[model samples]
Target: MDLLIDSFVSAILLVVSLDAEMIAIVGVSIKVSLTSTLFASIIGIPLGFAIAFGDAPGKRWMITILNTLLALPTVVIGLFVYTFISRRGVFGPFDLLYTQRAIIIGQLILIIPVVTAFTISAISRIDERYRKTAMTLGADRIQTAWVVFREARFGIGAAVIAAFGRVISEVGISMMLGGNIRGFTRTMTTAMALEYDKGSFTLAIALGLVLLSFSFGMNMLFHFFQGRSRL
Candidate 1:
């Protein structure tokens, strides 16, 4: 019990002091996560809009596939990407394995479904009148989309935020694809895992605290956007 208390105390101090190593780990995490989330948003948002508004055959099956993907494990994604990026694979010539870029690529795949599903939900909930009214006003396709986008902005924001949160907290992809290279690809989650294996708890605890803070912030932002969307 006393050891646990001491560990927490030391972890708090390390976080309060903004330990340089911790900052670097966190920086890598934020960089890769934000980059992945940005790419996912770009691809997923439009794809979602298309799926939600366009009449396509087997749409139910498509949504089912996407929803299933939402539960796809990070490690499975890691192994899948590794096969393509590792030596002797199709794209292995680029030598992207064990790099920050590799982590971003994996995280991108991980969150695209999240953004797409959330976007579809958001776009679906808007009253049908918005689209009809836009068309009635002589708005062209692009303009109509803009109108719908404006109305669904908050919900979309929450989706992107949720995607960011997903990548920031993930570990399996970072470990398998990034190799957890210190000062480079080591993210908060990977670093915590390493610290745990090394029997060191302070840094791990500090990183956990930082991760929890990010999660809390994301949830608050998500709810804030959701609330605004209701109005």
Candidate 2:
């Protein structure tokens, strides 16, 4: 009991002091997560908008596939990407395994479905009049989309934020694809896992605190935007 308390206090102190190692790991985690989220949003948002707004056939099936993918386990994605990037794989000649880019790729695949699903939900809720009104105006196809995007911005923002949270805290892909190389590909989650395995709780506790704080912050931001959108 006392040991746990002490460890947590020490961890908090490390965070307060801005420990260099902790900062580096956090930075790497942020970089990888944000990069993946950015790419996922770029691809997923437009794809989702198309599915929701377009008159394309098989839209229901596409949405089902995307929603199903949202539940895919992180390690499954890790393994899937590993197969392609491993030495024996076709793309292995580029040697992308165990690198930051590898981590981003894994995370990117992991979050694409999440972003897409959320986007679909967001845009689907829009009153049909918004689109009709836009078309009634002088808006072209692209301009109508921009108008819809403005209406759905809050929901889309939440989706992107959720993706950021998912990728930032994930361990399986980071460990499998990144190799958790210290000062390189190591992230807060992977570092905590390594520290725990090494029987060192300081860094682990610190990272846990950091992760909790980060998740809380993201959730707060999500709610804030959601509230504003309602207004």
Candidate 3:
């Protein structure tokens, strides 16, 4: 109990003082997570709209695959990406293994399905009349998509936020793909794992507090968007 208290107090000090190392880890995490989320949203948003509206063959199977992928383990994604990026692999010549970019790639794979599946669910919930009404008004395919897009904006925002939250909290991909190299690919989750293994409680606790704070903020935003979606 005393040890925990001491570590907690020291963690608060580290956070309040803006410890350089902590900030660096946090920065790397934020950068990787945001980059992955941005790209995933760009791709997933359009892809989800297509799946939701299109009647192409095998569309149902594609959605099933994406829904299954939402639960894919991060380690599996890490190892799968590693196979291609590691030396002696097909893309080995590119030297992507153990880099921040590598981490981003793994995270992007991990969350793209999340964003897409959530987006599909969101679009599915909209009234069928919205699409009919848009078409009745002579809205072209693109314009009709925009109408549904605007109506589903809140749910889609929640999807984006959920993607961000997923990647930021994940450790396996960051550790396996990034190699947790300090001053470069190290991230909050990786740093905390390293600190805990070293029995250095202060820094671990500090990062945990920071992580939890962000999680709280994310949950609040998620609920806000969810409420807005219902309206």
lDDT of each: 0.94, 0.93, 0.94
| Candidate 1 TM-score, C-alpha based | 0.98
**How many Å off is the CA of 3 in candidate 1?**
1.5
Candidate 1 deviant stretches above 4 angstroms: none
RMSD of each: 0.9, 1.0, 0.8
Judge candidate 1 against the unseen true structure and give its global Cα lDDT, from 0 to 1.
Answer: 0.94
Q: After superposition, how far is residue 133 of candidate 1 from its true place, in Å?
A: 1.3
lDDT tens per residue, model 1, 1-231? 987899899999999999999999999999999999999999999999889887899888889999999999999999999999999778899989999999999998999999999999899888889999999999998898889989999999999999999999999999999999999999999999999999999999999999999999999999999998888
| TM-score rank order | 3, 1, 2
User: How do all models score by TM-score?
Assistant: 0.98, 0.97, 0.98
Per-residue lDDT of 134-167 in model 2, one digit per residue for the tens? Answer: 9999899999989998999998998888999899
Q: Over the full model, what C-alpha lDDT does candidate 3 score relative to the true structure?
A: 0.94
Residue 135 displacement in candidate 1 (angstroms): 1.7
